[model samples]
Target chain A: MSDTFLPVVAGHAEDGRVAPPSTPRNVPYQNGAPNPSAEALRAQFADAVQRVDVVWGETTVFVDRARVLEIVRWLHDDPTQQYDYLSDVTAVEYRDLDRPIEVVWHLRSLPHRRFLRLKTLLPKGQPLAVPSVWDVYKGADWLERECYDMFGIRFEGHPDLRRLLMWEQYKEGYPLRKDFPLRGRFSRSEQLRQILAQNPEAKYSMEELTVLEAFDELSLEQRNRLRSGEKVGE
Target chain B: MATTTRTIEVELSTTGLDAQGRPQRVPLATDEAGNLVPMTPAPALEPELEGEHMLINIGPQHPATHGVLRLVLELDGETVVRCVPHIGYLHCGFEKIGEYRQYNQIIPWTDREDYLNSPGNNVAFALGAERLFGIEITERCTVLRVIAMELSRLISHCVWLGTFCIDIGAFTPFLWIFQQRERVYTMLESWIGARLTTTLTRVGGMGADIPDGWTEDLANFIRTFPAVLDECNTMLTKNAIWVGRTVGLGAMSADEAINYGLSGPMLRASGVAYDVRKDFPYLDYETYDFDVPVGQTGDVYDRFLVRMEEMRQSIRILDQALKRLPDGPVNVDDHRVILPPKSKATSDMESMIHHFKQVMEGPRPPIGEAYVAVESPKGEKGYYMVSDGTSKPVRWRIRPPSFVNLSAIPKMVEGHLLSDVIAINASIDIVMGEIDR
Candidate 1:
């Protein structure tokens, strides 16, 4: 509706043909040419950008967690850079527990035909939180939620940032975290017990139940339980 | 009030014929203008109910949902006021699982996520792994991968077409198109030895090459598949029911589609013409000639048209790939990644040592990360692998396209009728395995 998406990007030949993009042959593990947007990003947000690394011909710019949202907004809104597409929002937790957790955002500039990776590292001692880019790209909604669900990272300012891959009532630790065991924290029998103990009527969230306006008609005990900010139905 | 005698002459032809195939000539009442009088004075209209919105839940397990995707709809009468989609029904934690498995060992898991496009997933993962390992695949392997990708795309789009038809109440096309899907599966079965979960690629090469005369079978399929597609195209492309159900429904502008990270047919249908193959080429897809069909309105019908044309273009690519497929080794000559031949390993001690090391410890990529995306039938399916100089990756991430595309459903379905939600959901072509993964 805002008319920001251009009809065509680079790589088009003058004869109305798409320029042939060949597969990279014998690409090195590191030190490939970085995306030009990385230079522009560093120039635009000098203090926010911590470092840039070109690995496997992909450019990764590590930015300060506090300024990630502002940098992303600039990347999306800036006409010359125009990284309008948010490909993925995921986090990487190294096997070494002492290493900081890295949150990665893969952004594609269709107008400029460039791909840039933005990362923000959260140290172990501090709370793992990053600003949400939902305002810039609505597609980041579920990606950020899944990141929160999997890695227990708080996406500040994401509306309805509940657990995505895991249910709201799931009690086990983040499944993708380094400390989480391969065979889950709870034993199989405990997992089964938890499943059976779940209230069927609690399938709909409290926000969803408000649509029916059936709160008043509920049992007094159930109403009181819901009023106490508990999510249980019985 | 019509106490006076009044006869209406209803046009018999307009009323349609009876069971006997003749026009029924029932007595009719006419006003002074010779117009047909109302039957029973037009039954009084039902009183409008206001101030109450109903809630409807469609499956975590409904047939129309295609898979385990649940949607909670708040409806103001039959019109949907809001739609809240709940996924994760089939979340098996493939990414978490990928962290434990070796790079080559993770191929089978990729097949299970997007089960319909398993081969394409295999090719994408292998490409990512190869990039991380800094290994260059063979010329023959490159063309073979192109064939596999296009064939996989064909199968996926065929399944989409069949299921989409069934979703919109057309039964014949589903059966017809599924017959074609089975043919492709049969071909894949011969090539990979498994039909559904074909772990068809390794780090540097394919699982196997085409058996003798297999290219002829592919050629035959490419030759005859279009006729079947043409038949199906005639059946559904301009059908009055299809046009009525799909046109102008769940439309997204190009700007919104790109901002939402849509790709493949979903993005192209919005008229952006941004295809991963054309824009970011892999597997030498640039060498093959094909057209990326684009649509104007980005509606359900445009998605349908884009997929149909994409299948035809895949045929063209397949035809070109078949001709250009060179004669050489399928796997790279690198012993670190590819294992030695069994005969050579049995005879030569050095070959045996190479095989033993590769099998025992697995191929380890350098401490780095690579994100490789392929234009899967659903969209841009990407595999982002991060290695800490280990055979197993530090983090393995799947950028599932349907997950992002389906994220926009709440925006697309809010203002439409409840029935159109099914049409719109089918248009998104989501595989819950991929979305929930």
Candidate 2:
């Protein structure tokens, strides 16, 4: 942060403080990065992450997938650089790349009034292996799973890596990816039927099967066996 | 090793083969006491157990859930061990659709995202798009925008308060508040063409000018709102049961609130005075006379109080906006931004051509990116627009308030009782459309 921007950033931090006396009513919009103090903070992140790149007008900091756990641990535990919260973790699918997908985590430090965007690109065809940030922020568990479910970018250390909004037996590829059809293959009722078919033996009687009546019924064991592609008997 | 092979005579029986050439049931192996037992399949090796807990699915359509927000909660009985919110059930892919639509055509999509505050949603998108076009809105347009936004804020809060009461098992307040909310919709309908999804405010101005005596009607509504708020405050704010259910429940420290990117009433309830309007004033908000209310304890009660107080402040702001109503052209004169009137378009050749161009291809924004944040009813509603010097925006992303505020749910309800989940959710005031969009 430069000298001029330091006071403005400091003013924002001070304003965030509980019951600050005489908060600055108006702060001029300082669009440029003018404070050297921010440089030191930026340097700390530059040393830790593998590479920081600005692509397509977005700032992204890349880190090794293997060292994600370490990076998040430091980000949350380090006192001066405490990013105690993981705001969002979303994945973007780039069809042009060899990996074709990247997971991005937006982290924030409330005390310092600072934020950082962390990115990790995984190679295609390789088993997804990124440590979970659930232990650090607690909020990342669901976000990471959502990202995993949407982009097929797995978080290796996630507690439960099941489909979130989509049903368990959904065969379609990740929806947020570029290739995924915006208008899905199935109709609304068909989608519901597919979801209901996942748990066939749950016993929805005729009266209960209002909208989802067309799908065939099977026992839970039978459904599970079929889903696993097992041959029942010769 | 040499094995002695014996030819055994066996009877081949095919009594119950299905049409698919598969047996319906196979003979089972016999266990000790002449009891037949089915052969057990081998279990897949499981991951190492970190800990054990119970799992519960809250909703795809459960009561107390604001919309179709489904939460997979790992619980230890009454206490929430962990929460996983599953969004996208209400996702219409608004951002993706916006890319294909014209600038004005996208306003209705904004209304559906944050349905409770349609006007605010409209203004946020309109302002961002207008800023990109470098269109200067006249004084009358700005004042009208402020009034509409503040009224929408009050309406939004009324919905929040009503639904929050319902979540807490108080049904009467919901009915009482909705009665008042109906009036707001009626008032808005008079100004705009539609009631719920108005799509009222255009990019550089409004779709239509305010009708006669609209200010008096708004003033009358504003005057009545305070009494209705008082009734709600008396009914819920001080009720012993209400206090017991909310006070100190799902509380978060100021640090945690900010770090989690929590904003709106949730952040303000945590004693942070970071209202985007007050911090980053826009649309003549700097001249508005109002107070930014903050709460002491960052709990459900504090959030409730903050929103209630905010409704009052919104009314105050609305009063000032109505008092300072200016007379001027509602839309900017720039033909590139706003379409000419129908009369002019039909009569004049130049107007016809300008209208034709604007309708066929949208206004081309400058080659740059800008983010504008507003203190929406829910929280900080920010619009990030990237234009490539084209008629259509390259990228349009909304930093939705409900989406960010919903991130604090698990942290807020971590160790709290399962019953309190509804209270915490109500405090967050999440709209699934906004969250999933």
Candidate 3:
């Protein structure tokens, strides 16, 4: 596919007039030749892997959700293809597309000096999950958490799946999704200030404070009443 | 294993007796059936009394930390059993904001990531956008970018050396290095008009050309910097206190560093010699000649040594780039991509209209994805951009090097002394702006 992606360098389309590389997509402007290792990988994971595509010398291997763990584990364990470094884990949300989110994993085989991008597209919604590669690379611990924190995508076997950049109790929509607005959104500073002010020494443990922070502006009595289903709760 | 037996000086008359007038022997452990059970004998110093585990909080506000970095350290006595870092105090959600802004507008946002390496960040972002747009810049642009990047790396190392020395209780190196750092800012000021947050480069090319006689200032800086480093080495490096504190502290093996996704000096210190500039060349770095320094043992001292050597290499690259600097247009001449020059926009009709359109509606790149990486002073700082054939990008993702490098801190600091955490953290050279972003 990469070899055939010649992108018509200053060449003409079938319509007779010559076309420039800058006007269209995949126009082979600066020579994004196909990677040979991607072809070798396709042969290696013949059945498990669906397809391999190279763009601008980057190899992206498309696989099913169930095979992500197996594919990554084998990649790490294989003698020649030891992608031991899990560099970055991020998701791109496409609300209009069939698969709403693409959970992208960028892996590096440091000893071999190669890069592989593993992407799994999933249906968009809350409580989405994929297999965790934490066991394979320890660096994925926080990066996976950050992915979950931002996109609400769960890595199924992640040991401690907690929000990383955003506070756990700031319950709201995922910031990175297209559906979320860019401005005039929620900010946790006021609530954080009140919580900090009430507890001078921060006597509450992390777990306890997380639970308390859910009632943003409610008083202790009102929160108890709401929990107990008593009168005046509304 | 040989066991030492101590001859007790207890008098026979003082021996407690049971009903049969024999000495009563207390059992160390007992079985469920009331029968005495044998237990493993204790070693000379029975480390069994290691005491209860305690929690140690390092910072979110601690002065020793480089910035607003909080570490929740689970400790057993003075040793760190586990170190969990809590970041994001400086989170401005730069990626989310980038989605709303035009491609060129995001360069300033990238500056906030690794504030110490804004020029490098600008180049990395511009390179990514340029790839998506398929705009190959001039040779002059590439050379200028290389010079700015190397200068940024030098400044970053300067800040790292100063703070790291102060962190390890060496007071003088901090003062000496910042003097060099001040000169770096001044040199950059001559070219870009700002010191820290210059926002100096553009997508298709540089914002502008350097002022006259700027390279001479850079050449002067390069000439006299090594002697200062040598002076610093005299103060530390082999100094008894420096070696004792940093030699074996926070040591990690090569496999462990790779497994934790470590890069730059941290990875090189482990002897992998994996530098993105060499492994994956960008910005005509392949044309340059320099050797990557690798260290055998990944420790605080090795990281320091690797960084010092890297500074020297940066000087070498800078010298070469200055000598071979091309003469041509700095910004790409494509009006669709680049903002028109001020003189042309005011004087010519076509340039006036092109500048108006470009300023109002930003460049519309084709619907595609591009990821460009540069070997930043900290690590591989990459910009992953996904465009949707519009003025703004659909997704703007940053592979922040400092954040990734900071992830290896817990792995480096675990099982080490608490104070060694400071040494290990400094060795990583984390700027919280990058990590939190």
Candidate 4:
């Protein structure tokens, strides 16, 4: 939403800097032909925000995290750019880069038939916090929570921020990050067993107890006592 | 069979009761006595006045709910005060799995995303990967892809209409729709090796040529579909009860619909003339002549009408595609990406080696990302894939239309009766496999 990120979509970058070469041969429409209204809106967004980077291949407008909520509010409330819908909220982990994660928000305006992509980059190991867009777009609540649950990026003002896919007692680190092992054998079913074992009051069947203790060295009486609801631990 | 009715007295539980002339337990008090007593509690319960509403969970297993979606519904009697959708019950970590498998290997997995529209999923992923690979498909391959996709669309819509009517208490329509759908599955089975999870499209082109007698059979199927659709529409479309249940129910404004990312029939029914095929033309969609239907009221009835009109339009597109069907190779001549035919691989040594290498070491796509969206039966099905100059994708994400469209349900049924929730959900045509994936 800044002046630096122009209305024109940036092409894919070749050398990883300064933007990619523009393929004008397949340009869907002529650029700078008849764009008085769009140009004015672009200038307005530029005046309101900080730096904007237009990635070439993917048309994204990178805005600072602090001003994202303000930008989204303007985009949704403003009659000229009423981007009322939040299509997606996803994050990418750039392990090779100095700033590791980039959160992307895809917004669409029905009346104008226009699409906008907003992005913010977070430093490595830093907890990225952005204002929740739930008040502006009701559909964004679940998506923002899912983003947090997967990428560990926090949405500070979310009404009910909780792990969506993972269980209530999952203690493992974020599973979708690049640092997580891809093919490692870690069973969530097993994790649930460990949790149940620690809580003596937790009711579980004998068949379930047997399945949980199969991987570990548990005596027959200890397993039976646990299944029969007897407190086995001191 | 005449019978006499008799009343029997039964004893209810008395475990929590105390011996007294009157009943012991009070509504909000711990004990039966008239005197108030403090209850052992943890979290504080917000005070609710008499006749105030509270939240109730409808699923993870309720019959009305689809798959494993759980809805937290706040209600005042039968009217819904607030609604929240809880998902991820069927999540299998597909996006994470994509990072480990090769590009071609992911095609089979996409079939499970929206199992009803497997070919559309295949084409969307193939198109995304093809864009990254910078490969152009052959004319025959494009036509074949359109044919497969359109057939899949018809089948998907049939399944939706069938199940929707069933939800509204009509069972016969489901059988009628399934009869039509079964024919489609049989046709696809003959073309592709598999019926449901048909990995027909490859990155650069189609996997195989059309089987013998396929065109004549397809034409026969198309000729008979319009009559069947008209018959079904006549039976249900004008029914007073059906209209009463659906018309002006679950209404969403055009602005609200778009803001919630509702696409496909939901957006079109909200009076938006936005279809990926028309707006963002992919494959040979630009060449096909079809109408983009729009609804006036953006209600459940409008959504149903849009889908019915869309089925007619799909038939029109199928007729044109059949007429424009080309005679040539289905697979592109990009030996680097396409595998050789099985017959040729056995006879020719050069063909045999190419097949081996193409299967083992998948084609390397340039390091970049591409997002390609297609108009499936439900809505906009977009595949966003990022390649890292390797056979496997670095990231693969699906923008499932059902998942995004289902987000609009709370707004649709905010003040509607509880029973209307089931009808609205049916009209939305959500597939839980796609939503939870």
Candidate 5:
């Protein structure tokens, strides 16, 4: 890449709002049919939907977390809506909001060629849970598990929900939370010990466990100590 | 009872054998509530009369698996009854890591996800970032992205064919295809520094302008590549062993494939003409003319045929892009986005400050999210970006096609023989790193 390739990641323009959506979003469509305007979705789920906002040339509806399951089921099952494909499911940590955690879903209708993004915010608490959409779409099986894996956002009725990337018994906090340390909260020594204990046949090395950046800060003796998994700092 | 006829009474447990060779119970995983819970399969109904059924653990490590993938197969006398795929072996927290790094930093990681098509991943990632930034790339950059992407597809498909041929006991094609792959890699290396991990694209444009005469070399390579493909077709496509092993095997209807989230050749082979390139055009793909190959029966043979045709289609795209290569600045000339050139930075006052701020703090985008899907070799390789008005994205989710497509394995493998598992798995064209990411 060149020096010319530095910025633009944050966007060229500072204005967050996109130019108004091409068509009037207030116009409502028939139920079970697509091209559902922000108003149509509101009309469909009058009580549940909080608001609909267009960001970056797409529609993102901030819906009620409590009735998320019912709204999602309707959106998928409604013949007109038929958002059969669950393209992705992810969690975004706002870090500042009361709930702070927002679960986002990208749903697509193959026949209709329409895309919809639905988001629900969760209140701060332990044992985070949401209704599983695995039944509605078999593809949601792993996506939901991953959401739980990274954000500790559980799916209420998921058939098999467990830690995906991390060890099941791992008690380290959810790794994707804004507050979660880039280098994990626990030392590599403890993490390595736990994984090795669980999987004896695994071929992991000390190189994977120790942070090379920290090694630069260490003296030769300390570096050697780290390589040997010895606690030299304390 | 005939059960005494040398048939071992075996029940396959979910866990692996311990040091003592005794089958061990799989450790139950904790739920969100920290309660130990097993992801056990529902009890299989007892047959009217018992028949043989056993479970086999394929790999967290195995040759047939493209990378580190573990598949637990419940088999009934050489027939797969159920397949439960256990991923995450190669999970490096790529999405989580994206939260800490800049947009450019994520492209290299994307390459590693599907190393077989590193440039394809590079362009797909850059496209996602570019859309989020609302910066329309130059004509030259768009053409370059298309060329790189198409070339990567050609290379990735070669790897897929070679590996699949090996799975089916055909070794000659494996050796033969590598020669073409080496030539393609050399061409890629000529312009970009690395061959395999080619992180060769910038957000607004490419890493560097195409090196002198790179296009002509590629055109020369493409001219000879088709004869090799025709040779492969004659050698393997109609061979008795190849036909017997692949034809009418691992077949699924279009609806079932879609419901199971299949895409790319696997989806197209099932008779669904759904191609992201045509359906959801990006990077001026609408201007290009190429046919999307579709197959009637979504069988292993059909998948094989579709991908072969796809290689031809990619060649066509490459030719078109090469013909229409534009002359202009590859990177957008936005001072806010792109940095000032070295020559300008040394001589100017404002340009120097712009460089310092951009190099240190990075750009501050207005908080927003963008989902961009590119027609990658495998399928719809999408990047979902959520920016919280910071240089780093709050949520950078990769919708890997292999991950979604792999979900259809059980549906395709069930009722097929143990040997057909390899054929079906190969047809899916999975890259484990992408799946596990």
Candidate 6:
């Protein structure tokens, strides 16, 4: 990551030549015009761009999971396609357990005024992992973590890929997965018992305790348990 | 422990009198001609202390946090060395619950997420669902939605300004702003019969049309609202204390702001003229004449200025919407999504069947997905929904602006004084309901 912060060049709206943008009218379903950049992406990374579908006036491009990082970096750095904004990072799990999970990234090219959806499928049998776009857009930090916490889709290159909305010691499995029950896996009384049984001292993570130089003062068994990766709730 | 000395430069008003009216020693010294000039003396040098830092935790429960947001900071004396924000205390899995509910049934859930911007959230979700169902709302419905959006923006920004003043030690503005907020709420109550948790919009239209004389009330608000805002501006915009506390704190450049996905007032304050209403232009916003306010040197001060200006701009849009609100049905004519009138449903066989089917199994969109974003008071709030040709959405994701904006708290709070952390966090305008959802 670069230490220096460089401002992105202003968008097309800054130029006086182009007409002011207006609301899109009568947008067709499934056959609307695809973003020009989608074609440009296919031409640039022929093998990586799997499929481009225009649904409800938005273009969604399916890409190979391995090259997602390279593609996102190029999109951010490329002058004509400066998708400097990362709108959202989320994963979708189909009810049919046999189908592959689709991890979605919503990227916007402010300069070009284009919205694009990038999806990569994680087959059921294989590990649910994909490259992180945190290197390209720093906004992906919490988003990717939330995706992992909810859907168990691991973002491979995320620096601190821990549970976001859930506590670090939470052992409820992925909440948004197809197999996860609506009220949760544990009974209400069990959930209350688990909550009450949690250790107050574990509120501060091991990393935070290290910052206080208090980690070395822990008991031998506690240190051994922490070293063995035993979480508080476990 | 070793004793350490840290010299801090504090900006004090040159009033020459303390709170008790006693003559106080000012930072400025009088020259021979009795002219007040800045004092120049040899600065005190401090000895380096041992490498010891203190950890401070502020709120998952503290009032100044605005909501249930916990920020754990590692401080070196008074300055923050590092900030690790812990959120999700308000998380109830809104998105997870959304997958189980039908499209219209999900409208009430939207209200609970961003409670402050409930009407705006309803409109945004309706727009996304309408797109998924390939339905265009009526003209009157469009104008009504615009009204709801601008009204919600007004109230949300009012709450923000009020709480922000309270956070920064100003008590008067909080009362003034909340008074203005109550007026908007009154109009909302008369229109939708609900105040905070207003499921104002249905998939193709509104839950109900505005009550009689509601436009006059709105017009009255639009006229009187700016005066209160101007009063607030007079109180704090140039106040030396407000400037001293907020100026140059938690600054972000335009490029950095965009990279961090900051939106709404947070992005506008960084000199980025990106407003979703202007750029994306849903709900016929393109036809409305309103300027997108941008700020220079994005800081807490700039965020304040941007939000204040945005409330004024919202009034402008509301004024236009009121004048151009066409006379037509608020709901669409499609029986698949909207039910026929109760009078007609009882008389006509087909209307009764349509009503029964709609009530039994909710209206389902085709197999597709749509992501609709709106210029919410907080920022670019988006609702992304995917339909699998079912009554309930396959996946519903809320692209929360505050969540992304709050993620950059570490960058903003680091190297600042511990007290300024509160000010910086307030400027982010985060709603934990939306962030943790």
Q: What would the per-residue lDDT of candidate 4 be over residues A39-111, giving only the tens digit for each residue? A: 4445766754344433223455667788788878888888877777677788876535564587778776544
TM-score of candidate 4 against the unseen true structure: 0.78
Q: Number of the top candidate by DockQ?
A: 1
Give the per-residue lDDT digits (tens) of candidate 5, residues B1-437.
00011111113322333474323435556679876556665677756535655667788779998787777777777788877676778878787788878887788898898889899999988877876776778889889989999999999999999999999889999988888999989988888889999999978788888898888898898799988988897787645557667867888887777766778888888767667776666777767778677666688987887898889888888999999998999998876568889788899999998898778877655677878887888988889888877898888888989888887787788898988998889888999888877
* Chain B TM-scores of the candidates: 0.90, 0.87, 0.88, 0.86, 0.88, 0.91
lDDT of 6 by residue, B312-403 (tens): 88999899999998898999999889999899998999999999989999898889998999999999999999888989998999999999
Model 6: TM-score, first chain: 0.87
Top model by TM-score, which number? Answer: 6
Interface RMSD of each: 14.7, 24.1, 18.6, 19.6, 18.6, 11.7
Task: Report residue A158 deviation for candidate 6 (angstroms).
Answer: 0.9
> Mind giving the per-residue lDDT tens digits that candidate 2 earns over B143-206?
9999889888978888898898988889998988899889989988888868899897888899
Best first by lDDT, ranked: 6, 1, 3, 5, 4, 2
- Residue ranges of candidate 2 with Cα displaced over 4 Å: A1-163, A185-196, A200-234, B1-57, B72-84, B346-349
User: Can you write out model 4's per-residue Cα lDDT over B138-167, one digit (the tens) per residue?
Assistant: 788888888888998999999888988888
List where candidate 4 sits over 4 angstroms from the true fold: A1-57, A73-85, A95-99, A109-115, A183-189, A192-234, B1-55, B340-357
DockQ of 5: 0.14
Ranked by DockQ from best down, the candidates are 1, 6, 3, 5, 4, 2
Clashing residue pairs, candidate 3? none
Candidate 2 CAPRI grade: incorrect
Lowest-scoring 10 consecutive residues by lDDT in candidate 3 chain B? B1-10
RMSD vs true structure, all candidates: 8.4, 18.6, 14.1, 15.0, 15.5, 7.0
Off by over 4 Å in 5: A1-37, A97-99, A200-234, B1-52
Q: Please, what are the lDDT tens digits per residue for candidate 3 over residues B162-245?
A: 999998899999999999999999988888888999788998899879989988998898899977887886676555457656
lDDT of 6 at A83: 90
- Point out where model 6 deviates above 4 Å: A1-12, A16-18, A214-225, A229-234, B1-12, B15-49
Q: Itemize residue pairs with steric clashes in candidate 6.
A: none
